[model samples]
Target: MNEFLIKSGIAKGEGNWYSRLTSSLYERIVWQKLNNPLGYIALALPSLLIAYIVSKMGFAIGVVILALIIGLPLTFAAMFYLKFGISLIIVLSFFLLGVKRFVGDVQLGLLMDFLIAVMIFGLIVRQVQERDWSFANNPISKIILVWVIYNLLQGGNPSAESFLAWVYTVRSFAGIMAMYFLLVYAIRSEKDIYFLIKVWIGLTLLGTIWGYVQEHIGFLPFEMAWIMATPERYALLFQAGTFRKFSFFSDPLVYGILLAFTSLLCFVLATGPFSKPKKIFLLAAGMFMMVGMLYSGTRAAFILPVAGLLFYGILTLKKQVIIAMFFAALVLGVVANVPSSNPNIVRLQSAFNPTEDASYKVRMRNQAFIRPFIYTHPLGGGLGSVGEWGKKFSPWSPLANFPPDSGFVRIAVEGGWLGLLIYSALLYTVFHVGIKNYLLLKNPKLKVVSLGMLLVLFSLTLANYPQEAIGQYPISLLFFVAIAILNLSVKFDRKPELLHA
Candidate 1:
């Protein structure tokens, strides 16, 4: 079994520590040999001194200071060696960001930006040190790079109310693009791809459990306080529903859309060439996430999951999956219409019947209001002109007060019709390429992973028509990660899953 594990690269060679040197600089310089009193004393002097100093300071402050002094460098080192450290930080920010926002003014996304900046610095240093300078300088990266440059140009626009606003918008949007390229350039093999997919879905599952608990049971004190604080937002809930399971995302809509995507992906993966136990686990997780998604009361997101499932079937060239998916949907519909149907069915039915929906009416009005400005100012009001970004940054701007209502409209308000076209073109380009590659890629596993990502992207895009899905945390991070994975998958024809060293 040890031999098998070693062959599989699961077991690694190690130093049986304490006696046999793990070969640290201190091990040779101070230790000289295990339990040598003089060497031990020399090694212990700095730590012992720090402990004394800590005893003088309060324990908490001293520990914090010590962590900052020591832990930061260690974290940065891990970011380089593990290569997924930045990705994990980005993921964690997604998981905790909404909760952080509930607390106060310290922007959680800014922390993500800070970590990425450090990651970029460390990545540059590592690449230079190793003299290994290969990058995924493909069309997608180039397009994203150009888009970043375009956002940078927004910083100099005369219309921008606050320089900080422009800076934040450029950094937020362009940073997501940078993240795409970073993941693209960093991903080495199928192993990395699998690790990323698992982590992404693992977080989704965790979020589903949280959201389910929030609805079926109750929220934590902080969450309840935040929910109570915003009485006005209750009207904003889908159909003015009493409770919506937002989980760790920015809102119920975002959470529901993400759950829809992840739920579909889990179900698809369950049917793959996996062990029976793994398949069963995936199936159960998918169902649990689905229940959480239903609790979100996000009618707009409901339709997209079906679209994703259909895309999955088409992409995989599995007619049976399509037939089964339709059958499942039919059964769900029948069950939904039963005499004792779930209240969720009534809420979701409103998705297809939105004529009287208050939110839908408001959205229509918003679209009408934004159209004239979009047509007149074809270039745009600027990046932060409308939506939450607008209110926080350009509160004085008239456009800032009015909601943009849709991601598509928000793009139009910020970047103009031309900008929306360009953005849409970029997305379609990736989608087309992913579809083409799904058919062309020789490796079935690569095909499955990349295709699943494309479907998720597709679902998110559809969901974005009603809400800004991509720019939000976790979604943005995960979306770009998928794009990067798809970009890297293009290389499979030339090289297999193995790393180049």
Candidate 2:
């Protein structure tokens, strides 16, 4: 029987066929090793160390070291495995740290650290594989490259301090690219996109609850740790020893931005293809986010949720609702403008009137003084230059004591007009891709995602005019990811599933 089978060529020989199959299996096993858990641990070790240090040693020290560590191989591994995981981790950690100097200060530093790690990883990846630099043809990247070169030229000889600062600035721009790549690559499937949205939704709700509890009950559990660690600022804010809510975010602005973004997501989910119970839950979350936004006391914070609703209404063909929203917005604006006995109204008026307001005037005066330097320098002062210049060039400037009030102005001052142009172009591309996808896709699910992302991007762009929105890791990461997802969809001609209306 064996001879007959062999002669017929049905089987070489029973043992021969078995051996070939085994050899093929063995070769595959040798060539493509199964992912080991130890590898993940090794990769995450650097980030874990940073997290540990931040938890134990406070933010300033932790952030510097964290940045250094992230530039290493281990943390790079974790970031590679998860895709946007490192960015999300650092952002969430920053949010957890809140306005307490340890947390807020560390957040930026950690972001820098993560970016350094990503750059190192990118270099290695480029070395290992032949990458298509066609993506570099992106207008936004070109603009940023020009901006960096301009900074190098204008800044004169790049000393260690200047170089490091330049590195820091360039890293921020590169980090945005890394985020974009990660999103496009990792979120190929609708399931992955949905999972990310769920994570964002949960975090939003948690942030809102934290803000609510801190505001109403004067209870800040984890957040108070950092506040207590740095009691000086707490003392300044505390009137009658009552703590104003920073929530688990760096400041009220951060909290407000988070709420605004989350509320936009909630609005999308509530109106999208979710079940009745899920929709109800999302509606409740949206309401909670609105309450949290009001408590955040960020004047520009209202722009996001309001703009989101406006966009959604317009997209859904609800013209009357859009009109109603506009009227409501006008009423709110008038109320904010009115001189009132209420302290909140007084604060609002001060914020609105930049000329008479101490804070607003200081910001304007600093900008006016910095404008000439920015124009002449062309490249920019450097990445850390804006903050450093504020301290060195204009120590008395209000911005020296405070953070940059506007993201666009911050980039323009630090990276130059080139940087600003690049950033703007990047944002414009996001909107363009998002809108294009929305128009092209017949599927309602894709349309909703596209519209939601577009709304977030638009809201963020508007918010950037008033606050430093781009530098905030969570929002920036979210913005890039959304754009990447849309771009990928367009490239591959993949259609998202339709929602049952």
Candidate 3:
């Protein structure tokens, strides 16, 4: 911590690079020593111990396999999170939290959130230490600041019966917004953008692999137990020889929606102006996610890539390609929906023919019962008024018992039409920013990224109509990360200059 030792410790003038890096003070600096094999061993020793503790034994086959699966990435993230903090948290937020009681029913979401909080807290402490107070000045930062305030104010919602529900639901809002700010703060260059995209693809590929295993191989005992814990959920998943795979996610529906959006993202990345190897990898990743999407049995999730690419075709404005894509999609749609005994296809077909779907009819009936109340309570019933959080924390509320099948419906029920309008405006503003940046920026990579982002946002918006894709674990984290990337990619000029790195 000595300033003179830090500044005069290493020389920048022409010298032997090896000697410069291996200076006495540099050797004393633990972080600098981490560049060597000795430091790697030092770090790995502790990590091995932690993994052993997590597995409850040092070298059991299951435990070893699990440790090998996650330990490398966990250690990598730990070593580099401070430097590449936003990207690390965004990736880990989805993959780690979806572990689904890996620690004997102890949820990892809170643990992940705590880690993120500590990362941000360190950033805050650094800013304070350096007397630099200029990190959160961007337009995106302001928007997120407003959102944090809005969600915090929701605790005052009169209809929120239990403080616990408010706490439970509002944390997602707060956490996602915090992630948004962290991204706005951390992404300082094109390299950071590339790093984020790389990480996104890697996480998508990993999730797809886990989803594939759940579909084809098997599930962990706790995962199956979670399904069997609820009779209705189990029945729905096991219907007619179809076992919808939830994988590491909390539910199959959420899993499908996540994969559905990632399919669009990877598909776009594949077709983008990236390298051939990356493009091929992305194409494979897209196929994995697409397959996972199909097996998820969340019929509503199918529209995401279809809708995203349709918008993408319009953006391209290529008459032939547009025409071909539209017709191809139509043909594929017809084929996928062909009257077959395949339960997956039948479930998908029901999305197109909702009237024949009993669940759809029941949802409509449920909507009729709640529409009048939403109309009257323009603001909303309150946060946590419906859904799992509602049942747990606000069971006394009428909306608590009633199921709001769609994301928009849940928002409308909780915050009323007013809340819906605000949320929609927030989402549209994001799309508008991405589009505006795409049109204005002349950079080819930026254009590809921006256009892809516009489509991704569009896809998520459409998916929200059916699945409450946002405001949930993994999905919400991924959503905000995407938003952050798109926002960061923009070429903003209103400010004279950025205040901090």
| Top lDDT prediction, candidate number | 1
Per-model TM against the reference = 0.84, 0.69, 0.80
Q: How close is candidate 1 to the true structure, as a TM-score?
A: 0.84
**Angstrom error at residue 121, model 1:** 1.4
Query: Residue 481 of model 1: what lDDT?
Result: 79
Stretches > 4 Å off in candidate 1: 1-71, 98-103, 127-134, 234-241, 335-342, 497-501
Q: What local lDDT score does residue 198 receive in model 3, on the 0 to 100 scale? A: 74
lDDT (CA) per prediction: 0.74, 0.62, 0.72
Best by TM-score: 1
C-alpha lDDT of candidate 1 relative to the true structure: 0.74
Residue-level lDDT tens digits of model 2 in 135-246? 4455444544554455445445231124455455555655655555445544546666666767777876777887888887875455566557666766634533344455
- Arranged by lDDT with the best first, the candidates are 1, 3, 2
What is residue 44's positional error in candidate 1, in angstroms? 10
Q: Over the stretch 441-478, how does candidate 1's per-residue lDDT look in tens digits?
A: 87766766677778778888888888777767788787
Better of 2 and 3 by lDDT: 3
How many steric overlaps does candidate 2 have? 7
